[model samples]
Target: TPTTIPYVYAAEEDRCAPRHDVLIPSRMRFTGSTSFSVNVFNISLAGFACDALLQIHRGTRCWLTLPGLGALEASVVHHNNEGLGCAFENMLNPAVLDRYVAHYPVPETEELEA
Candidate 1:
């Protein structure tokens, strides 16, 4: 199996957020209930990335519903053939995101631990 990167991808300026694909539903509710199947490509302290079939225009506001994380308000920061980058505008529960991150733990080795 391929190893997963723990850190979120970022540009040099760290302005735009990065993304990834989880193929899981980041259930969203903006105009209505839309379940989008996406993989979280990257994540930062601010936002994350996911494969979106919908063309997410810049500055578009949407809600994200994680499996256990509940819902969060997010905005489209960037989009391309890869996916849409979104920044968390309002988190229904911060702990939800926290727990999700914690669930995907990167193994610690002696050299890395040192």
Candidate 2:
């Protein structure tokens, strides 16, 4: 059986903000690491989940640059072998999140793991 990597200590009930599924290309820079391209598969006012090939640990500071937006600051809250979940230092604007959902549509036929 595959070992499950536990996320940071927040309980499931703590995730009250709605999550929007999207497949948007963006840039991310982890502290002490250079910027790289990343695919933000899901997002919310508080955080986002993205594809991260690099090995990262919890509490890693990072900045994500979404299309048409400045780099949104966040910290790595959790990570598994394939991806990372990051919490924003400041909540994202709801209006911006709405625009992103409108711009990027994850093809319903394409089933994303996250």
> How much lDDT does each candidate structure score?
0.58, 0.81
Off by over 4 Å in 1: 1-13, 16-25, 91-98, 105-114
Write down the TM-score for model 1.
0.59
Error of 1 at 31 (Å): 2.4
Reference-based lDDT, residue 101, model 2: 86
Q: Work out how many backbone clashes candidate 1 has.
A: 14
lDDT of 2 by residue, 12-101 (tens): 238857888888999999778888999998998888889986667777789999998999888888778658888887888889989998
Which prediction has the highest TM-score against the true structure?
Answer: 2
- Worst 10-residue lDDT window, candidate 1: 4-13
Q: In lDDT terms, which candidate is top?
A: 2
